[model samples]
Target: MIESGFAKNLTGQNLSSHLGPVSGKGDVRVGFFWTKVQLRTKNPALNGKIVNRLCIAKQPIGDRYTVSHAYISQQDAARLYPQEFGIFTQYETAPANGTPLSDIPGVSRSEIGLLELHAITCVEDLLSLHPDQVSQIGMAASRVYKVAKGWQDKKDENEEILTAADVQAKAEEAIKAMEERLARLEANNTRLQAENDVLRHSASGHPAQSAAVTTAVQAAAAPGDDAPYEFPDDDGFMAGGDVVTGNDDLSDMPDPMKD
Candidate 1:
């Protein structure tokens, strides 16, 4: 039995008086109050008896109140074990964008009975259904499944599902092609650089060669200066030697014209 009370204070209220008298067959007695009261049980049958205590408080100043209560049961107390469950709502058909049935193109949302199939709640389940089974219900099951699985007949870049290996292979191929191209470009650059260096060296030497030729011509033009000439050593005669000023005693050739 449960009993509750509210008052300014516990001074005159008899706590035991509220409990009344126990009948002949009642095994346990129960009572609660804001103030403390003492009771005892010496019976072996009542030993280790469990009691639940509760205190409820209400608000609003003058209306503020507190009530104490206890629960007593004859059965042995047991711990409650909680289990989790999911609630699946059943519709006449599947929900739109919830489950697809076929892979056909241009299938309208209105035409597709998305809320019809039983035991098919997700797109994955829809994709796993057989075409014939879906056809029995007068729907394009295969097409719907394909669409749900993101497989379309047309070439859609977004719909392609490449495996890791396939992607890796394609990447490797692209890398190889790029490397080959880079190698060709590097080779071409190397060849061009070599040609440029050769051209630069030749251009640099041309000025020096021209200056030397001018100096030789000027020396030859000066009187008493050596003539610009060349002679084969094996030919005893001064076959190719010519004096610019024509004042040469062959043995008096200037050092510039010698050897």
Candidate 2:
């Protein structure tokens, strides 16, 4: 059975310095890592190789946490920290926000997974990184640099499209706001029209034509000649004997003999 190994810190902290210097003193293999002895390793250059920081593959695990590797050395083995020599490493790595490799022009899932193993997942993260730092993740440093450069170029080319998308989103929001305002105006207009109709019905002198018709009906119901009453066509009513029939004496009657 494979032993998952006992977890001390469980966190991927390197302890080579704490155990004592592993690099300077020995018959130890010249280019060998002390990792085989099971002492946790740091970014290899932690002691003094600050310039070699790029060679140290640090996976950005969120804003926090890193699954660091710990290698054992002959010095560590000789010191007898562990019963024997063995490498202790974090098996499971945590996740962070990085661009998908698939979105990149030529990156495959495997290469994407490789980058993730070190915590560089997104295009932004990948591009933001220094070429030297990217080199630590493995394969060939040149190829990684090439891929990152290519993706950066792709991003540059598509910048216009991104800008257009932002513009479109803002325009759509503005149109939606305008439509809502128009709808409110329409609703208010309809309500006002209804109120106007109610006021017309409740008014004392509404429908002038209808009131005229009603007056005509009442006049028709009253006893009256079909012909409309006419005023004196001439102003000679006073001179005509038939015009004023009121207090005329017997002499008021018209006589055909006189004509």
Candidate 3:
């Protein structure tokens, strides 16, 4: 039974009376909380002393309001244990996130109630129950355990498949990025090589051309001793009177006759 009257924490505020009784028979949210309880002593020195106490807070199903008398005393908790087995389980073993017993496949209401009587409130609790404890639940304990185990196994397998797919996608993205980078690098290298070739051609072309021109000018200005000199006419013929042979002893040669 829940306490009726003002809660110990809030002065002159009747929380339990405002809200109806709280029980774990129905769906409710249960969580731990700290309550500030005011102490009243006969001695004047001990009067008005406030202390913090750890307790439970119960809210309606679907995350509704916090019901009255959310914080139940030890005596109230013990009395309500048979009705609110969840509270007793939370008080003793703090279970982690898990599927509710009612949600387990092939589990009936009577089986759930029986399991709760033994402080097994969730799927995790049932799966981890000792063989001895499971035997205590009756002949159908093994069947119920197998069903919960199957559900967990299937969930884990799905998670693994999703993880593998995610990993593969990331790897593909990384490979694509690396390939693009390599292509850019190759293009830059090719451009640099072309520029180098152009630079080499520009640097060597002028010097070679200038060298050929100098050689031709030197050959024309400084002829060999045996070289001949001649004057050409517009008809592509050498002028006969202007020809000078390399032999200096030409005094005996006959003079040209005027036409």
Candidate 4:
């Protein structure tokens, strides 16, 4: 029924300037389009009002096809070029990646069906329609468009919030890992300093007392007693049961008497 009045409004125009020169294979696009038309009202005040109407065009075959382009009504295009029309319909109805019309708040199934009649299949498609083209859906156009736009804006904001939250979480994890590493390093340094103090005291103190204390401290500090063994070269006792001093000479004291 919409296509019945298309003939009354169809007007000729040059598409070559916009579509570029037609190829030898007669390749030209066919789809619904919005075109501006002056109002036919008798009132001078209303006569200047302009409106956009949806139109379909197809490139005809043979001699007329040689003309490069032809504008036709949707019904006529479907009747004359069924294959091209079928392809157009298939592409329009195909699954798209954008948010579906039904997903938006306040957009009912009946309203979605009405929008589909005008070739708007998704939120993005609906958003792209001109305000005048959108008004063709009658009184509900403004409400539907507002809701779809609002839904899209809200979705973008939520995504941004989530992205920021993820970044903060990763940063917190990195800081926690660094803190753990510093704590372990501090503990290792404290233990090393304690071992060094014990070793220094052993090297400077009396040999007999120091040896006993050193062995006890080392054994407690290191479970495996992994510290290196160190024996003083100047220690007095030797293999023959003689006491040798620093000069490597025997002691002058006489041996204890025997029976």
Candidate 5:
């Protein structure tokens, strides 16, 4: 259960205490929360097996509120993991510019559903679905254009407001992914480089041995398998130099290497 008191973090004010739909025995409680909402109650069904200390959040209920004592959904708790904590899910912005049609400046809720039925879900959808099709739903082309333009402007404005931290975080993800890939490639490259070095070393003295090694190496590569890569880690191939990229096709090692 979430503890009671003054609020802090991403959610500054007391959480609105709306009586949510009670599902089942409230025993197997479940709901999908974008940012997990904590329940002030600690029903037995919600406790025991599916508990995580981090899922707890302060939320107002009835006259009073609880903080740290309330528990959130298990799925929500799991969702919050893998990323650094303290920064709650609420802080994250939408991945894309477009929002629900009702969120557009002049679009109303009732009209949103009607447009949704026509597959005109968001402003981005407007770009795909022609204005003529929207007009079929009795919506003016100018009005649709206005909402779409507003969403575009809003997206641009919000994009400009992105903090340096946001940019850095995105960069970090890209860099992390790149570093992991580069490390695998570097290792594969080193192995290939070592093999090439061995072939060169063998050629320096033992001409016959070098010839045998070359044949064995070529045989290990298999028929038509040029510059064999396919590292064991399931990483995609990295071509060029000793490190070859592209193609996930794995080939068998020759009988000589089987020993």
Candidate 6:
């Protein structure tokens, strides 16, 4: 199985180089926030290489915890110390903001992991992610691509908050413009509908006129009693006090007003 390792100094180191020597038990106190070294063996092939690196440490405190080379596996610590109070490498550290990527000694930028990059909590973490991976998590590809290219979010440095009166004025102007356009379209539609009704009334009278003309031409072309022209009743054709009659031999016909 894959295993993880971490190393911490049980005893605190001397701070003499930075400050003068203390008399008795020393002023520096061992604390939880002291530096820690960690190593991981995700696969078996890297186990021996990791173990050998941890066995050579002469001292386990001070600048030792600060260097990346001080991290080692449990197997090598057993071989080197073989006694009490040697390097006690464990499997994990308590959850906290990890060491910053910039402050991790001897580790290069390329060797950084997702967790390590997250510790930085900066644009560097965003840029390290692949574009496809970002897209898979439903983030915008262009935004991620811009981040990878070292782009920062746009900030309106000179922007000032608008007053309430300014916001109200802009809203009123927009509503007024929309209402005016709606009123103009309504007027145009009414005018077109009136014009269309007049045209339709005028067109209805032509069908009866065309039928009468056709009957007259037929009567003139025929000479014998064998030809008979049937005319429909004209009582249904009255409009605006005008009575329109169908075609007949009007030379001998009486006016309907006299009848």
How do all models score by TM-score? 0.23, 0.31, 0.28, 0.29, 0.25, 0.20
Question: How many residue pairs clash per model?
Answer: 15, 15, 0, 0, 18, 0
C-alpha RMSD in Å of predicted model 2 compared with the true structure: 27.7
Between which residue pairs do clashes occur in model 3? none
**Model 2 lDDT at residue 100:** 46
Report per-prediction Cα RMSD to one decimal.
33.0, 27.7, 27.5, 25.4, 29.0, 31.5
Winning candidate number (TM-score) = 2
Tens digits of lDDT, candidate 1, 175-250: 7767888999999999999999999888787998878888878777783424535555787775565556644554
Q: For model 4, state the Cα shift of residue 207 in Å.
A: 66
Question: Model 6: per-residue lDDT, tens digit, 140-228?
Answer: 33343453344222312222333454556556666776788899999999999999999888867698887788878887887456565
The deviation in Å at residue 132 for candidate 4 is: 2.5
Candidates sorted on TM-score, descending: 2, 4, 3, 5, 1, 6
Candidate 6: regions farther than 4 A off? 1-162, 210-259
Q: Tens-digit lDDT track for model 4 on 65-93?
A: 33333445668767977887777766755
Once fitted onto the true fold, the runs of candidate 1 whose alpha carbons sit more than 4 angstroms away are 1-139, 142-164, 204-259
Give the C-alpha miss distance for residue 229 in model 5, angstroms: 80
Of candidate 1, the 10-residue stretch with the lowest lDDT total is 80-89
Task: List model 3 lDDT by residue over 1-259, tens digit each.
Answer: 9778965677766565545544445776555554456666443333444555547667775334455455666565556554564555557544324567766777898887777677786788888877677976787776777788898889787997887876776666667767888999999999999999999888688997778888778878987654455444576564366557786444545534433
As a TM-score, model 5 comes out at 0.25
lDDT of 2 at 206: 57
